[model samples]
Target: MKKLYHNYIDTFRGLSLEVWWLSLITLINRAGTMVIPFLSIYLSDSLNFTLPDVGWIMTFFGLGSVLGTWMGGKLTDKIGYYKVMLVSLLGTGILFVLLQFAKTFEAFCAGIFLVMLVADAFRPAMFVALSAYSKPENKTRSVTLIRLAINLGFSAGPAIGGVIITGIGYQGLFWVDGITCVLAAFLLLKVLHPKKAKILDVVKVENPVSAYKDKAFWIFFIAMFIFGFTFLQYFSTMPLYYKEVRLLTVLEVGLLMGFNGFFIFLFEMPLINWLENMKNSKTKLIAFGLFLVAISFIVLNFTSWVGILIIGMLLMTIGEMIAFPFSNAFAVERAKKGNQGEYMALYAIAFSLSHIFSHNVGMQMVDKYGYEFTWNFITILALLGVFTLFILLKVLKKEKNT
Candidate 1:
């Protein structure tokens, strides 16, 4: 146990101070990530929206993310990630407060679209910053630590959000969420060193278009889209399933979501760091994650018991632990020196694209077919993704991304 303790702490070694601050910012911002988790519920109960209506709203929000990440990525490479992150964080905070005032359905739709557009721009910028900040060999640990901070924040956000939800309702969630976003921005603006050198100081080719032409990147894009599409269902359909199908209350539902963060926090970093030390292949680990995620949804068809929910959450968390950080690291590894932001942007954009189309598809399927059938559909999609990714990796290895 003592040796295990030292090994776990060892993962924290060699990360730069800038990456540490970036992780802190991720924690602070994500800790206030109350809005997205409960957005579908807010639309359904508070605004009296049908499931399909909520789906459309979310799809639009995803579209906004697509714009945010693309533009943010371009700007990050042109100017620098620091400026992009500062503007994004500050602007998004203000938008969260504005969201509370948008009461009518049209107002809500317009507000959500704008807010996510501004909010999600931070993603590509942050990814660029993370890659720029970390030492070469420490990329996996740096990225994993950032995710660990995110889940740590997630653990606190929903529980606190639950209390605020009970006491002051969803509007309270918006206010709290807004305040935290601004706080994160303020920390960045005031404390973060402006003149800090980027990982690659000289800017290289700005054209990410060549990346699109690469057969390898397209394969990566498809695999990422599938991973993102399936992973995102936890926010979309799963919450609704727990409430409407399982008949759980708001706090109970919050606890269920919190379980995902809790388990990821407890297990992800230590486990992944250990795996990295064991010289695990990134693609193989990713395939394993995809299989577990597929089984997590399919497991629900077998039983509606709350235990099954916990079991599913645990499985998906483990999958997330293995898959997500490695995915980011893999992209960074493949990126030619000067165009990391563009690569990261494409990855973020593909993920947001999943939010736009595939998630809405899931929502429609859930509304039409109900939980068991919808989950089974997602399972089939995930399993197909696993097979496709296996073949995809064989091609990528030949392309020498190995």
Candidate 2:
């Protein structure tokens, strides 16, 4: 047992201080987003805004993220990832603090929009930096480690936010989120030294715009967008749906989200490795995952019991764990070297856009048609994602033959 423990410690000892710091930064940032899952409740119950109004407010947040992600990628390519991440973290922290004083719905929306803009801008830079700093052999594991950190933080953050909101109210949640962001910025700056790279060093391909011409790339991007359309319900609508319709307590909702993070922490690395070694049929795993997610939602439609909901959430988490990282690996394989930032930016934008549309559409569908309709709608979206994956597999085969 002693030797086994030592070996485990030795494995992590190979990771640099920078990689560790980056993971910490990711955790902090994700912790700040804990309030996001419950934002609809905050807006409707605490602030007295209607459901439709919350949807409109979220549109601004999504718009800001869309622009921020694109600009962040370009800036990382030009000014380097360290600078971009620092700016994003510090700026987002200040915005979070400012949001506390927002009196009107418009003011609250604007504050959150700016916060998401800066916060999301940091994501691409962070991912690019992780890829750049790690050895190629350890790249997948490195990314999974970062994700694990984020999930761990997320697991705790939402539960904490839920408790804080139930105990002290929404303002307390904002304060906690703001403080975490500032601390994350400080830790990142202290640990990650900004290294300036020449334009040539940063821009290896020179023409990142050409990636759009790749058919496989478009298929993957579209599939990811559809996947996001279904997956986003966990953040946007699930909490509100459970609280309002199923009458779950805040603690129960938090516990459900915590379960999601726990599953990812336990299974993500082993799943990634297993999927990577699955011969040449990686896309089949993605299709299977999408099918699982769709089935999970369909099963959810019949359950008002908390136990059943938990089981469905576990299935959804399994699907997410299988699909998300593999999709990223697939994108990287198809991308031109040195243009990863642009490709990932586009991919991230798809997710952001999906969040915007799905939240708005799902909220309206739930209000008009009912929870069953919304679940069915998301199921169809997941199935569409599966169809796109099949198309991508065909495209990959053709590319190989060429």
TM-score of each: 0.88, 0.85
For candidate 1, lDDT tens digit of each residue in 1-402? 999888778778888888888999999999987987788788899988887788678767877889888888788777878888999999999999989898877888889888987888899889888877887678888999999898888777877898999999899999999999999998887657576544632335555445566676777788888888899999878988888888889889878877777777767778877888888777778788888988999998897567988888888888888888888888777665446667788888888898787767887898788888988888888888788778877896786755
Instruction: Please provide, for model 2 over 1-402, each residue's C-alpha lDDT reduced to its tens digit, 9 standing for 90 to 100.
Output: 899656545445445556677888888888887668787788888889987788788888899899889888788777877888888888887787778788688898888888888888887787777766666545555667788888888777877897988899888887888888888988886767655221111235665654456667778888888888888888768888879977889889878877888888877876776655555465888788888889888887785676778888988999988877666656554444546666767778889899779877777788899988889888988998899899888888897899
The regions of model 1 sitting more than 4 angstroms off are 41-53, 165-170, 196-209, 240-254, 302-309
Clashes of 1: 0
Highest TM-score, which number? 1
**Model 2 misplacement above 4 A:** 1-17, 162-169, 194-203, 206-209, 236-253, 279-281, 301-308
Query: Clashing residue pairs, candidate 1?
Result: none
